[model samples]
Target: MQSAQCSGRTLRFGFFEVDLRASELRKHGIRIKVQEQPFHILTLLLERSGDIVTREELRQKLWPAHTFVDFDRSLNKAMTKLRAALADSPESPRYIETLHRRGYRFLAPITPIREDPAESHANFNHAALERAAASLENDQSQDHPKTGFLLSHPRPPATWTWFSLLLGTSTVLVCLTALFLLRVNHSIALGSSFGNLNPRRSVAVLGFRNLSGDSQEAWLSTALSDWLTTELSAGEQLRTIPSESVARMKIELSLPNVDSLGAASLSRIRKNLGTDLVVVGSYAILGEQSHGQIRLDLQLQDTQSGETVDAISETGTESRLFDLVSRAGEHLRDKLGIRAVTREEAAALAVALPSNTEAARLYSEGLAKLRVFDALAAHDLLLKSVAKESNYALSHAALATAWGQLGYDENAKAEAKKAFDLSANLSRAERLLVEGRYRETAREWGKAIEIYRALSEFFPD
Candidate 1:
């Protein structure tokens, strides 16, 4: 029904005027074959014409109800398709502009036109069917003898045949209704499950309390916390809180050290962390060998109900910290019936990044400093981290964070964009911070921190 007039013969934009309804791309009057999802993405860009579309917004629009899709892969593929179709290189994009950490924006103009005659006829038929029942209502109100006779009855049918027909029709309708209801119920159940699924799993890993009487392993608690944060972060499913925040909370609560905390302090720590899951345990160094044991106590408590859905503990040795943490992660996944990333997949992700043990250690140190609001120190450490491993996505993300904290918006954005371009696994919070959206940035950071905390408990050294 909607139409517009075009004064010119051609609707041109760098040799392309995509047909939105048909989901077709035409370059200089030559058709370009674009896949379904990419075509939808192009259509979305065309509709937005002159505004920035955030990646989050695009994800929600394109994959509104599906969570299984690899959004990063699909989105990048679509963008590649678009660039190829438009002959626009990423280095010097003309039609579509990539806004780095933000979303995409259409750099061209789009003009609407009236539907052609054949298209108009097709639309009319579709509209006519949609209005058919309303038209019949008006027709029924009119004085028409044929309509009245037809409505009255069908006569002279065989009684047995009529009965059989009626029975068969009723049975079919009942079956259809039952099937529809069953599907509706299934959808409702799945909807409930989806509602319970939080992409950001929050947990607080309390620093290990040093129970050993000797002061020789004084730094053990801090080292354990840092190690756990790093090892646990290896799994993308968890959002571990930075150790600095936990340390700050401990100081604020006037708790001398993690080991000095009692049951009350543990509860207070959980509240301060504001996490769904709380991890509490103690560690002791045995003899000169520095042998230590850790027990990971996990509790998923409801904020409203104050009840725990999951509560379990796992014991492990310092030598097998990674294995212990992986086991705890499995337990948590089992408790929630959540899907997990396989070890091979996790290793692949780790290898794909530009980070080694030293770079990771520096990055972790920088993150801890950043958590305590030490922007200068964090920046210095993060710079060293990236210098050590230039392609490290997490380090780039951390550098972006430090830059943003120091008011270097452009530099921060550029670094963040590079990080995401290299690997989408950079903590979500780091990505948001680079985008200049503080609230969302904090939210994502919190989520990442919580996941780290949970992992730390399971993998304590």
Candidate 2:
């Protein structure tokens, strides 16, 4: 462990300085905006500089037993914030180095300043006086008797005093002007590089849980979640992660079908799927089973902060489930401050979706299966869906994916062609997805990549 006696309480590294007593970090003598947690972490690392600081050690020091926090996630976020403040990188570290599953170590060499804080100001003044005296001697000739005057006398003559004041004032002006330009340039670079650090928030709509207690209606959970995912993607300002991506992540992470999650699970989703917000929901059939009412409950969660941003509950009948989806999605977008759907856009979406509820259910379940690589199950469900509604372009496209994965090349090609033939009325994003699926099934890898790249560019998070 590093000792204050070995290196004074004030430590300097690169162009930055850390004052342990003040609990402050400064770059070029200017303080940086660092959060309390990150600042504390930095102090701990500095105290153990050049040694590995185990994550367990940090948790004990930083959080109390009753903290009730996600230690791993909190530590990772604090490290990220600390790295940002230092403009450091884990990949090519200049100050802090990560040790994979072990811990982190500080890499920079530290220099200690004077132990006596009281003498610091006097030391600075003495240096400045020396420089000023040297300047006077250089300006005057050796024969000038006053060359050693500044060194001999504690105070300078009035004429020399005026000269020193003028020099000091000019230096201060130059320094201030330089600092101003540096700040302006830094602001401009940040704007151009990160667009004020606000990117389009990426959202993932998880499969809703079935609370109706009827196993037959399990498909409705996937269907409603898929519907909301599509509707949310209609907005240009929100980047909705594809249902396939969410399904794959669910299977990979072994996440349960639920309306809510703990902070650790949410953090995993955010990191693995690159999602900012997650929409977890549940649906139930109420009152009567024959022509029962349906209730949809959705909660928008900020994955990073693990906070509920908004909750929406919509009630409708089975026949108007699609309408309920539209209403919930609209409310969700509104809560996010995204633009409302236009009439033309809404019309296109209506035309693209299958009007038959049976077809929608089969298609949703089949798509979910396909995303999880359950090729045979997806193939059977998708075939039944297309039989129910032959012209459902998305169903055909998804069928193509299922068929391709099942190694039925001929059937995949046929479904791909059928999807393209029926895609004329599809939304722009839907059309791109169909075309990319078609390219993939046809073995046109390059063309498929180009189409997917276009999709990502259009919806970039």
Candidate 3:
């Protein structure tokens, strides 16, 4: 239990306070209602927030030890009423959350106030005696002070009584005052943290521009963009937009000169895609050899701040495209503190298809064309890629997405299922894509669109 003061009240977390002298529940400064028998049950639970307060224990506290009551029903009713009054639910609760077969736990943190330690001690000593007097008063023994003292202690003189009462009242007030100050401090801290949060701490990867003069290199660009999107989305913490949506947005707001799409364009892209950061990159092949060197120029810019946060270029052999993507992803992870899927784990989960194989290469090229909104061309190339290598899962998945986009639901569903079966670690977004195609086949356009939006977040470039 923590102690603090807020608004001149002593608000207590555990153990309900019953200031019988003032007829209030003053844990700190705020007054909690304690109407009737509910107060007895509340007090017991408060004293032991995380511990079980058995029905028998509550009955003993509320009624006499010898008294017999229908413990189960009455106790349950009281707890339900208490929870209702406190605005707490057994399911998805905040304050008095339930613990199933066990008992309840007071989840709220408690703060108590300590004002004038010396005075508090002195008042405590006197308050005990005053309470005794009050108990006697309730028992119709107020007049016979000496008679009450035979069982306990006698009341003092009138002047002494008034002085003790005043001291007790002052102590309660002090507790309340301390509680108020503490609450205000806590509120301020929460408000400050919330206010200072930067919404521009998010980024999206746009589909990479294919600068390979040869049409065969197109797959490499799509493969790089798709892999990067997957790596970024794996971070989970970073708010990455989906590649599919970015691809659509890129075509919708086609800026001819890629370099001309600066801060203003980035802002428009972010607004259109509902993202904070935008990433744009281009890839190029520099030789005619099968294992040519590929260069990637990548940039990350904050939409709201209109400033670049990261800009770097990586060059690697085209044969090691996946490896380059992995390295690039690691770089971004280090720069932006983005979490990444481990190489060993990612490799183990990856669909085991020959990357450098002709079929895989063709599929990768088709995917690239699809990224740039050339769906028909992409479809044709992807079909060729699959024909050469029917076992390539990625090509099959890409083909499925293309088919779905072009309204070939039956074919898309079959391909997506094959992808799901072949790929060990299909992302949530990818799974949604498969489901979306399945839903589309059933003519559920609304649900299919919803799934597509979700898939876009993971694939958004």
Candidate 4:
């Protein structure tokens, strides 16, 4: 906890000063355009400067009991908005620094004005709040085109890294495929307003219950959650607890599935993980006579209230698992009103599915293993992927990262070069990732960081 006794309920960091009572975030005496969620997030961060504020702490304090929200996504979006207001970067965060899968910390020196809570609110400066609200509304009303959601799709979104039907085009085509891989956090059913889920609630996707009674299918629990989290990774639509974080928790509890979670368990989850949305579901084999058919019962609930904000059920066979999951992912994306580049549009842009699903699967698993620090496994998988499909640029690029992790500088550089050579047809988003890798492998730290900064800004997936 930060002391407010030094200043009078006003906190200053860098060029920005946040009057806690006024709920106004201003730079150089002018208010910045920030919504309530972003402003509140900044205020909370300022209240705990220098110390790390866990994602759970933010949810506990700011989100009310019964506040249905997407805490992680909201926090990320708010942080992004705050950074934009402060002219900061994640590559080199100036004020708020992410602690990877842990949480965030305020990096700048903060000047706090301590004052009586009653006194501060007595002089709340409603005028400033009004000004901020007005600025936000004005910005929203302006002609700035946001890629809003489309409601017509039927397929659930699959994890971009995993299930998008890959196309074996040129290296450029491979890069383009990577661009279409929008990360998903979690899925929620859409209502009339498309604003039902608490936009700023931090969330966790617990393992879906495997009622199939077959231990072989146990991997579905974590894998499905991981996929949903990846699907929701576009921009800042939802804050998803990383699989590694969730895995750590699972290791501690040894709880089999989310269906077995009790109120006490739920409370522990909320406290330990700091989640706002509890995505818990169950899956069962469709019929004893059926070989591969299964059904998923999924729902997004308000952690504090234990209320189901949204829910959906989908059925498919093992052969169509990818399609089923992708449909669910797409439904969640649509509910959130985020626009995705359609398959037709992508095809029109000359993007085709990779020729080998197995290669694509290897690439996906390699990336996953790499995320969990199992670089050796990732390296092996990446190698196999490229060997299976020699034209798989993503596999090569990922292999470069795995090699770098294992201290194989020469191998890393060679793989990176191969990726770059194959990237002539990459979209802006794809080019940003490959170019940054190219620069980094060449030891151009300045260029790599600069490109990464731009990539973070332009393509935040």
Highest TM-score among the candidates is held by which one? 2
Local accuracy of candidate 3 as per-residue lDDT tens digits, 148-248: 54354576899999999999999999999999999999879866746444343556677567776566565665567667777666635566666667766
TM-score, one value per model: 0.39, 0.57, 0.48, 0.45
For residues 1-461, write the lDDT of model 1, one tens digit per residue.
01231232224476676666566778656687778877777766765767787888889988878578878656765666666456554434577777766888878765654556478799999999879966766666664635542254456569878998999999999999999999999989867745544456666566666576555444445444555454455455566676656766754555554323345555676678765554545565545453566554545444334455666566666555545556765666667555675766557534444435466556767765565445567788889888888877667767877676554577776777667665645444334333333322334566555555554434332
lDDT of each: 0.61, 0.81, 0.64, 0.67
* Candidate 4: segments with Cα more than 4 A from true spot: 1-223, 234-278, 282-291, 304-306, 334-355, 364-368, 418-438, 459-461
lDDT per residue as tens, model 4, 1-461: 44643246677777777887788887877876777876777777776777888878878877878999877555655655665556554545678776755667878887675665576776677767988888766665563437333234366667652444453335668776666553222222233324443545366877698787777565566456755665554344566776657765663444556653456777777877788777778988877677777788887776676667677788887555555666666766675566663664334223212346566567767765665445567788889889988875656888998776555678888999898887665555555677789788889999999988996555333
lDDT per residue for candidate 2 within 1-461, as digits (tens), equals: 45863357678888788887787888888887788898888888887889999888899889978889988657876776687577664545789887755678988888887556668888888999999988887756454665444334367789999999999999999999999999999999877855645577889998888897888888887888778887887856787887767876875566888988888999999988999999997988886754688988989999999999998899998778879999999898889888888998899879878899889889878876655445567778999999999988989988887665444578888999899889988878889888887887788999999999998666544
Candidate 4 CA-lDDT value: 0.67
lDDT for position 100 in model 3: 38
As a whole number from 0 to 100, the lDDT of residue 354 in candidate 1 is 40
Clashes of 1: 13
C-alpha RMSD in Å of predicted model 1 compared with the true structure: 19.6
- For model 1, give the 10-residue run with minimal summed lDDT: 1-10
